[model samples]
Target: MTVISIPGSKSVTARALFLAAAANGSSTLLRPLSSDDSEGFAAGLTGLGYEVVREPDRWYLTGRPCGPAAGEADIYCRDGATTARFLPALAAAGHGSYRFDASAQMRRRPLAPLTEALRTLGVDLRHEDAEGHHPLRIEAAGIKGGELTLDAGESSQYLTALLMLGPLTREGLRITVTDLVSAPYIEITLAMMRSFGVEVTRGGPGNTVFTVPPGGYRATTYAIEPDASTASYFFAAAALTGSEVTVPGLGQGALQGDLRFVDVLRRMGAEVHTTADATTVRSTGGLTGITVNMRDISDTMPTLAGIAPFASGPVRIEDVGNTRVKECDRLEACARNLRRMGITVATGPDWIEITPGTPRPTEVETHGDHRIVMSFAVTALRTPGITYDDPGCVRKTFPGFHEAFAGFAEILDRRGPATRP
Candidate 1:
C-alpha cells in the first residue's frame, strides 16, 4: 500500500480563512489547502483589508475584527462555491461594500436562498447580473441579527454562511433552518467555530433551530485535516480495484464530515480501517450495492455512483437535490456522463439508480465541475478508456489532483493517467 499524504481540507481552509480574518489577532493555519478555491478565499480577505501571507506548508493571516477596512471591494470567486457562498455573509457581517463575480457557469447558480436570507438579516444584496444569482452587489449595513428563517434544502452553505456570522451579530442570532440538507457540514461549522473560541448552540438535525449569542471568535492557531472529500476518490478506487490505498493525516477523529464517505464504502463491503492518525481502504473483492441517502455526505455521490455500475446490484443514491445547484447539475451530470459510457443510469429529481454493467470506453463531460471529473476518474479505474473534458476544473479544490491521481495509478501499477486522450 502506498501511503499518500493528501492536501488539507478545502472546507476547513475556507472556513478557517474567514474565521481568522474576523478574529482579534493573527492566526496561523498549519497545512492548509493550496488551491484555486482557498486562494480565492484568501484573496477575498486580502481585498477586504485583512493581511494574508502564504508560506511553505502553512498560511498566516491577521484579523479584521473591526470589519473590513475598505468601503468597497471586488471579490473574484472564480468557481469556488464555498468562497462564493460564505464570503457574502462575511461581507454582510463586516458591513463592507462588495461586488462578487464568478465564472460564466457559476453566474447561473442560485444564490437567492442565501441572498434572501441576507436580506432578512437586513443586508442589502442585489443581483448585479441576473436576478437571484451572482454576480451580487453587497451594500452592507451589517446584520440586523435577530431570528432569521432560512431554507437550507438548496445548500447547507446558506446556513453555514449565516451560522458563521452568528457570533458577530449585534444582538446575536437565532436561525431557524428548514429542509436542511448536508446536515453534517453544519456540525463541522459548529466544531470549527468552537476551535476558534465560540460555541454555536446547535438545536437539531431533527428540528433545526440554532441560537448564537453575541460572542466573537478569538484568534487561535489551528491545523487543518486532509481533505476527506478528495480522499473518497482513492477510497472508491480501492473498492473498484483489488488494491489498497492509505491517506495519512486523516482518521477517526478528523474534523471534516465528508470522512463518512468511508462508512459508505465499508457498507458496500470494502475493507476500511481508521486509527488515530490515518485511514486505509483496501478492496475485498467486488462491491455489493445498497441504497444510500447522501444528504449528509452528498459531495461523494458522484464518487460512489462512479463505481456503482460494476457492483453486483443496483446502487441507489437519494436526498441530494441540492446537487443540482452545485458547480453543475451533478445529479443530471452523473446520469448523462455514466450513460455516455454505456452504463444504465436512472435519475430522478433527487436520486440516481445505477445498475451493474460492463462500462464501455467513452468521454465524460465534466461540465467544468471538479467533482464530476474526479468521480468519473474513479470509475475509470475499474472501467478503462474513460477520458474527461475540462479536467483542469479540479483546481477548484484539488489543484494537483491529476498529479496525485497519476501517482495513485502508479502505486497500484494500474493503467495510464485518466487524463490521456
Candidate 2:
C-alpha cells in the first residue's frame, strides 16, 4: 500500500495562530502548516506587533492577552478568509487604528456578517470600499462585549471570529446564531478553544446560543492534524484508479469535518478501513455513484466532482451554497471545468450534478482557486494531457502539492493495478 503524508491543517493552524496571539503566555505550535495562508496570518500578526518566531517544525508566539502591541497598523490579508475575518476582530479587541485589506479574490468575499457583529459589540468598524466588503478600517478602543444575534448561513467564520473574540471582551459574549452552515467547523473552533483553556457553553433551542466567558485564553502547546480536505484528492484518486492508499494522522480522533469525505468514497463502492490513527481506502471493485449532502463538508465537493465521471451512475452534491462566496464560486467552477473536459455537468443555486462519461483531456481553468487545481489534478490522473492555468495556486494551502501528488501517482502507476491487495 502507498501511504502519503499530507500537510498540517490550514484551518487548525490559522485558529491556533489567533489563539496563540491572544493568550496569556507564549504558545508553541507543532507541525503548523507552512503555506501562503498560514504565512500570511503569521505576517499579519507580526504587522500588529505580535511576536512570532518560526522554526522548521514549530512556531512560537508570545501572547499579549491585552491585544496587539502596535498602536496603528496596516494588514494585507492576502486570500485567506480566516485572516481577513478573524484578524479584524483580533485587532478590535486592542486599542489602535488597524486597516485590513486583501487580494481582489478575498475582497470579493463578504465580511459584512462578522464586521456587523463586531460593530454591534460597539466596535468602530468601517468598510473603506463597498459596504460589507474588505478594505476595512477598525478604530479599536477595545470591546465591552455583550449579547448579539448573527446570521452565519453564508460563512461560519463570522461566528468563529466572534466566538474567539469572546474572552478578550470585558463582559464576555452570548451569541445567538439564526442560520448556520458548516456546523462541524464550529465544533472544531469550540474544541480548540477548550484546548487553549477556555470553555464555551452552548444552549438555547438546538444549541443556537454560544456563551463565551471572560478571562482570555491560556497558552499551551498544540499539534495540528494533517489536512483532511487536501487528503480528499488522494482518496478520490485511489477510488478512481483502483489503488489502495493509506493516510496516517486522520483517524477517529481527527477534528476536521472534511474527513467525512471518506464516507462519500465508501458510498461510491470503495472499501475503507479506519484505525485509531490512520485511514485507508481501497477500490474493492468498480465505482458506483450516489447523492450526498455536503453542507458541513462542502470543501471537498470539487474532489467528488473531479472523479464523478468515473463512477457508473450520476453523482449529485447538495446544500453547499456557501461555496459560492469562497475563493471563487466553487459550484460553478466545478461545473464549468467538468464541462470543458467533455463531461456532462449541471449546477443549481447550491448543488452540482455529474453524469458518468469518459472524460476528455483539457486545460482546466483554475479561477485561481487552490481547490480547483487540486481537485482537477486528481481528474488528470485518469486522463493524461490535462493541464492547469495556474497550478501554483496550491501554495495557498499545500505549497508542494504537485510534487507530492506526482510522487504518489508515479508509485501507483509503476505498480499498476497490482498495487491493490
Candidate 3:
C-alpha cells in the first residue's frame, strides 16, 4: 500500500481562524493548511488587527472577543469564499469601517444570501459595485443578534458565517434555515465552535433552527485534520489504476463529509476500508458505473467524473446544481474536459452522465479551478499527455499538489496491481 500524506483541511483551517480570532485568549492551530485560501483568511484577520504568527507546522492567533482592533481597514479576500464571507461577519460584530473586496472570479460568485441576512439584522452593509457581489463596505457598530430566516440553497457558507458570528453578537442568534445544501459543512462549523468552547443548539423540524448563545468563545489548542476533498484525487487514482492507496489521519471518525467519496468508489467496485486513524482504497481489478446524488459531497463530483470514462457502464452524478456557481461551472467544466478527451458525456442543469470508453490524450482546460486540475490528473494515469491550462490554480487549496500526486503516481507505476489478502 502507498501511504500518502495530504495537507490540512482548508475548510477546517478557515473556520479555526475565525473561531480563534473570536475566542477569549490566544489559540494555537497545529498542522494548519498553508494554502492561498487559508493564508488569505489569516491575512484578513491580520488586516483587521488580529495578531497571527505563522511557523512551519503550527499557527498562533490572538483572540479579540470584542472584534477587530483596527478602527478602519481594507481586506482583500483573494479567491477564498470562506475568507470573503466569514471575515465580513466578523468585522460587522466590531466597531469600525471596513471595506472588503476579492478577485474578479470571487467577485462574480454570489454573496446575496449572506449579505441579505446580515442586512436584515441591521448591519450597515453596502455594495460599492454590483449588487449581491463583492467590493462592499461595512460600517460596524456591533451586532445585536436575534431571530432570522436564511436560505442556504446556493451555498452553505452563508449559514456557516452566521453561525460562527453567533457568540460574537450581543443577544446571540437564532437562525431558521429555510433551505440548505452541503449540510455536513455546517456540522464541521458546529464541531469546531464547540471545540472553541461554544455549544450551539440545533432543534426544529428536521433540525432547521440553530440557536447559538452569546458569551463569545474560549480559546483552545486545536489540531486540523487532513483535507478529505484533496484526498479524493488519490483515492480516485487508486480506483482507476488498480493500486492501493492509504491516507492516514482520515478514518471513520473524520469530521469531513467529503470522506464519503470512498463510499461512492466502493459502489463502483473499489475496496474501501476505514480504521480509527486511516482509510484505504484498492481497486478490485475493474470499475462499475452507478448513479449517485452528490449534493452533500459535491466537492468530489469532479473527481468521480474524472474517472468515469473507465467504468463499465454509465456514470451519472446528480443533485449538484450548486457546482455551477463555484470557481467555475464545475459540472459543465467536467463534461467539457471529458468530451475534449474524446469521451462521450452529457450534462443537464444539475447532473452529468458519462459513457465508458478509452479516453484520448488531451490538454484539460482547468478554468483556473483547483478541483478541475486535480480531478483530471486522475484521468492522466491511463491517458498520458494530459496537461492543464492553469495547473498552478491548485495553490488556492494545495500548493504542493503536483509534486505530491507525481510521487504517488510513481509509486503506483512500480507496484502494479494490488493484491487482496
**Using lDDT as the measure, which candidate wins?**
3
Instruction: Please give the lDDT score at residue 104 for candidate 3.
Output: 93
TM-score of 2: 0.98
Model 1 C-alpha lDDT per residue in residues 1-421, reported as the tens digit of each score: 7688788999999999988987888999999999988998888888877899999788998887667878899988888888889887887887668999988887888888888888887888789878888888989876658998888888888888888888877888898887788888888888999998887776766658998877678999999999999999988887777777899888878887788898898998888889998999887547888899898899999998888887889999998888988888999999998888888889899999998887887888999999999998887776668888688989888888988887787776653322210
Score candidate 1 by lDDT.
0.85
| 286 Cα displacement, candidate 1 (Å) | 1.0
Ten residues in sequence with the least summed lDDT for candidate 1: 412-421
For all candidates, the clash counts are 0, 0, 0
- Candidates sorted by lDDT, best first: 3, 2, 1
How close to the true structure is residue 294 of candidate 3, measured as C-alpha lDDT?
A: 99
lDDT, residue 5, model 3: 95
Total residue pair clashes for candidate 3: 0
